[model samples]
Target: MKKYPKYKSSGISWLGDIPEHWEVRRNKYIFQERNEKSVKGTEELLTVSQYTGITKRKDKVLGENKLLTNASSLEGYKTVHKNDLVINIMLAWNGSLGISPYHGITSPAYSVFSIRNKNENFSNFFHYTFRTKIYHSIFKTVSTGVIDSRLRLYPDDFFKLTTLLPPLQEQIQIARFLDWKVGQINKFIKTKKHILELLKEQKQVIINDVVTGKIDVRTGKPYPKYKASAVEWLGDIPEEWEVLPIKRLSKAVKTGSTPPGADDKYYSSEGINWFTPGDFSDETELRNSKRQLSALGVSAVNIFPPKTVYMNGIGSIGKVGICLDSASCNQQINAIITNEKISPYYLLYCIKSAKQFIISFGKFTTLPIINQEETKSLIFPVPSKDGQKVIVSYIQEKTEATDRAISRIEREIELIKEYKERLIADVVTGILAIRGVEVPEVIEDIEEELPEDEPEEIENKEGVE
Candidate 1:
């Protein structure tokens, strides 16, 4: 990282100082808002995201949680062209804005703009600069809303903001330099992620083997006497183990419900912790949720006690977690109150080990779904209380080292991501100069480096904690 010989105050305070040769200009002078509205709206639909920037709607394979579909009629949608910058008015503060690589139609809720002087500037440079952490905070300050989620960055406010104006050639070079560096970083991350996935698969195998009685936890050897489990999934289990349907092992098997309407009053920041299928991940404990329900909302749903095991009944079928405290869940989840016959931890592992088998029970519709009756009918291999304890301990002891390795690699990925963000902030803001730095002739997708087609893919690739 190098700096120019001279520097000058930006006078904007938050902007601090910049290279003496650079100029600070209002966005209005640099960008002209495109107000063209489409009559037919037959062009490809476009979307902007904090992770992926601008993308064609069809490019993303969305999940049930955040499905994107076309409106009844595409009429009146805003028209976008290549090199145009699109901003989701309500989410601009969260970095949901980007320069489109394709000509398309976007939602009217977004504001579209194009650079006024293409020869003297580059949209890609601003795309990189604006997405930096500092700009996210700046957008938050300028956006107007009653709450954080509702904040909007309208054309007028966005145009009023000031930005650094690097020389045309410098802008291109800086963007090019960043593209090369980020690609190298992303490549390293991909490799680390592959290793992490293998570790997870290995752990899953261990859990599946012990919980299914495929392995004897007591002597670390095969069980002497194996019996036909009768259940096809549990072919041959220890003679002492029994195959029992979930309904037989639990006091109750209950499904959750959503409230009547979409009223915001039904939800609160300090409300009851409400779990959903999305809340269950690789972790065993279901501690918190993305959204909570107010008392009124809670009235419409059933709350299960702590230690209750939750299994996904829809969407991501078979994913499981246990509540660390009393919690209410949505319709997508099934809560099981295990009787003295089954330990919650053992039941949790049982559900996890039988994920693929449980998934098979789901009716393959537009999205896989399993109802309460089906969930209650799913069978598992059960052992006595003492046996269950031994299996649980065995799993903990066997997977502890693998879990630690996974955590270490995850933290390494997080640190690298943080470093990448900091590097972008410094370089784009002129804290580091790339004037004489040579950029490779060939660079990968510049703006397309971060965002992936699926949200889950992005989580596995760039997200780990």
Candidate 2:
């Protein structure tokens, strides 16, 4: 049984100050990250293995659409030999860092490091050390904002963090043992992720069956029908339904533009919503956002009263939602005014359904943006005013139920992951000390080389070496 310190931080606290001889340091200073690199784009390019450290980029490609490839032909791209560490600066926040154990070239997104020293105890020891949850938690907590996600730790910061270094012999044993253990955990996590994907497909199947009048098949057949008119997205509709451009159906299509200059104070976190493409999450009510901008501050910008359906026209464009209350949008989003002809709720649902396809049509360099005309062109099956209400209410109830169920499952998975991290920390650190393990040393300096293994006398200690 593993023994933990008696001073108790509850179930497990794997960490404590190391021996006086050891030290905590940032990783960047101990090893220099290579730059001025380009992908040769050829000769067995390497890519991050979603499950492990390194794999042939093409080997992992599966299924119908292989949109992303790690193919390389250019020779200039840097090569990473076995035992090198690589971390994607952008995706690092998402736990994208891994040790490379195969011959491969990483994308420029990764900061490749060559281990300078070869202390057997600390070489791969540091690599596994970084995988500890406590270490990465420290890395992620400091990062925030758009660029915060891209925070890259240089060697200085990296080497500064303290390490609880085990003795040389134990280091090798622990590294090899935990390496296998981590691989198993990773496989388990991947299985959970795959199961989640299947659940989503199953849920979509449920939606298709019920929403398209497939479920309750016999009685749902003769539900209702409307005639074909010039519907926005769907050309023909029920005979009794009205087909009209959104322009005719609502107040003018008003696009919000930002005022020329404003201080950050104008965008207060506590005021009315100052929405942008990023602020929108739900496709339902555009309601006030978690983020707000002061009315006086946004006065120079295009502000729209709430209760209007909002569509993002900028990057991540075409997400449609209804505003919960009075709010203003930046130029990239359009605050739409709808008239009595179409129920706002119904229109929001139609837009929400079409948004994915509409967003696919967005065209722009950096920011994929959609024009008002394209948005208005989205077509849908129109029911009579009364039918519109029925369909809207029905779809809302169903979709929200699906969203809640999915969210609950996602939360449970997150908690499982947290528990898993705690387990790893307890094992890796001394808190849940494995039997026969000695107290750890906090590494202070990167060492240069490992001592040679001593020769042993002949003995039948084991059947295998």
Candidate 3:
């Protein structure tokens, strides 16, 4: 083993400078692949996972391998030796790759390659590097033809990828450093995620208190004041407040059409956003659409101006967003065009908080529907316009502040999650090895899942480990 200096630079380029004694080589020059077929097998089966790496062979996870009755003579499945790297080349883009340190049997879908190199640097380094962003880029960038979503990487492309090498001693060292650094970043990210969860809980608490009248907006207090004169959803709203149906309140109920898509020239990357379910998923509200349409697209569909109250229906029923600018939604949405006594912000808060209620009365077996009449018949709590103004103003200031803080923390948490994923990827791949790392042993998931039936009868299964 040799002592290597800690050199700093951007990206993975600095990874190339290994200890002076190491041999460097492309993957193609070092290994030959044996493509195996599926026959009767008794190997504890394994399957490739994108979010998670390869997992232990269970009944259906290898899918339909149960028909074989042979005690131990299955020969079609290829054998993987401990510490040999195995990847599902098809799902590699999604990071469905892992190292099998315990020699095991896996599904024929996986292309199991054993590094034939007798050199010590090979095993110590190959597992880690294959999962790195640097190596993945090398493999993906040069592949010809449209890569099939389901097809595993061919031997040709798999063999041609660029590789970074280090002396046997440094391979171990780099892996160790990556392990330590990623663990630190992961801890920071976990802390931020916990804080975000706490903030969300606090936000929900405030919303429940105020909305449910547990906290009186009038007295600026809670739990003491009660009123007998109340409506169903608006039960016991402050006496001064008015309960009204949505039909009399709004100006018009309008829906949008799908934008024209035949003309590619009309739509460009620079056009204004076209709001869709993708835009509002997970409560994310910003101005970016997967597909942008032009003026024709806008005309073909009704274009909503900024500040429109957009609520989703069908597919993602009751999901709501206040459009920040002019945009159109598919026919699945109802954009209310109203201004009188309507605080878009207040309406937004009300609708978002009441989405479950909105969908509660909806009817359908395969698909649910919230009727326009039902939407118009929605009962709401209305304080004085002056009170509405005050509350809306208060909510704006408070929520904007909360949203900004939450956004910042959430972004940090995301970066941390990436770091954690990268850390795991690095460790499992052997690019950076962390010895004796603690895996949260008490995974509650396995115990909670109630499978519909015994899993022995299925073919091609996807599971979370």
The prediction achieving the highest TM-score against the true structure is: 1
Output candidate 1 Cα RMSD: 5.3
Mind giving the per-residue lDDT tens digits that candidate 1 earns over 246-286? 89999999998776664677788988888865577677788
For candidate 3, write residues 1-465 as lDDT tens digits. 123334222234535444334445667766657565445555566655443344564522322323322224545766666665666655565455666656566645456776675564546356556666656665565544463333446667778764555555556655555445555665665567668778766665555556545566556786454664355554676655666667766776667666444356546577766665546633425467776777666666677777777776553467677767887776667776656776766676667656667766565432445656666777666665676676666655556666778888877766766766566454433344333444443322211111222121112223111
> Please, what is the TM-score per model?
0.80, 0.63, 0.58
Q: State which candidate, 1 or 2, has the greater TM-score.
A: 1
Off by over 4 Å in 1: 36-42, 62-76, 219-281, 286-304, 310-319, 323-337, 356-379, 445-465
- TM-score of decoy 1: 0.80
lDDT of 3 at 395: 54
- What's the C-alpha lDDT at position 3 in model 2? 61
lDDT of 1: 0.82
Put the candidates in TM-score order, highest first: 1, 2, 3
429 Cα displacement, candidate 3 (Å): 14
